[model samples]
Target: MENNEILLKPAMSFAVLKILPLIFLALLFLLLAWYLSPFFVFFSIGTLAAGWYRLLYIRKSIYLVTPEVVRISRGIFFKRTDMLEIYRVKDYVITQSFILQLLGLMNLTLKSTDAENPVIWMVGIPESDVIDTIRDYVQEARKHNRIYEIN
Candidate 1:
């Protein structure tokens, strides 16, 4: 069996999945404001604009999905990378708050056996299939002990 050690990150545009719900809630406020006195319009506009910025940020936060691992990298001044080995992974978890559930989005956590440490989270995975695919690959890595690349 090959050793599996790598990082997996959320797919690009995942950030959009997060900002969208806020936009909706903001819209709700805007509507309420319009009903009351139009003062809430600014809040709605600001939320929409921020959501659009998130969409653009989502355009940039790309992920590298490989056979043995997934890599998340972004930013020029504060570039960062996270790695998680498939073999080291212990289980999979999908979480969503009431708002996230309402938005049809979720956060996928790849939990390792390290009890003292926190699990790695891939936030804002919109599609259930995307989460499933990741779980499948992680399982496959465990099943065959797939070798992974760190890059």
Candidate 2:
């Protein structure tokens, strides 16, 4: 059908969970700077830099589900893009942890036949019918490709 229809773009806020420890350490360093040597301020800056790096990495990731394939592009300095043919998709699972539920986000994991990247996780996806859409597309692709599951 059409080429590259955008499917899901996860929110950058997903990085919050990943970078939370760095942020906490940065705050601690800041507190230390207030009482101890000013050099602790530099440590705080370093932690913040690390957090910023993680934020950019998450912000740059994209998940696209097309009629024939699923495209996942991720990275900041070294970008890598992966494509999983929809016909190769075997199953999918959606999960929402307690913190993710509170943030109104969920994770979508796709199981594929591709040997190199069999499992792909789409995190921080906003709550919606995304799984349904992907499932529909997977079926359509399988039909179009004449793919059948023997087992």
| Cα-based TM-score, every candidate | 0.51, 0.91
Q: Mind sharing the TM-score for model 1?
A: 0.51
RMSD of 2: 2.0
- What's each prediction's clash count? 6, 0
- Candidate 1, run of 10 with poorest lDDT: 1-10
Off by more than 4 A, model 1: 1-60, 113-118, 146-151
The residue pairs that clash in candidate 2, if any, are none
Which candidate achieves the best lDDT against the true structure?
2
RMSD of each: 7.6, 2.0
Q: Write one digit per residue (lDDT tens) for candidate 1, span 1-151.
A: 2333223344444565657697897889788897897878888888888777766655555455555666666553466766555466666788888867776667777777545334766676564666556667766877786445454
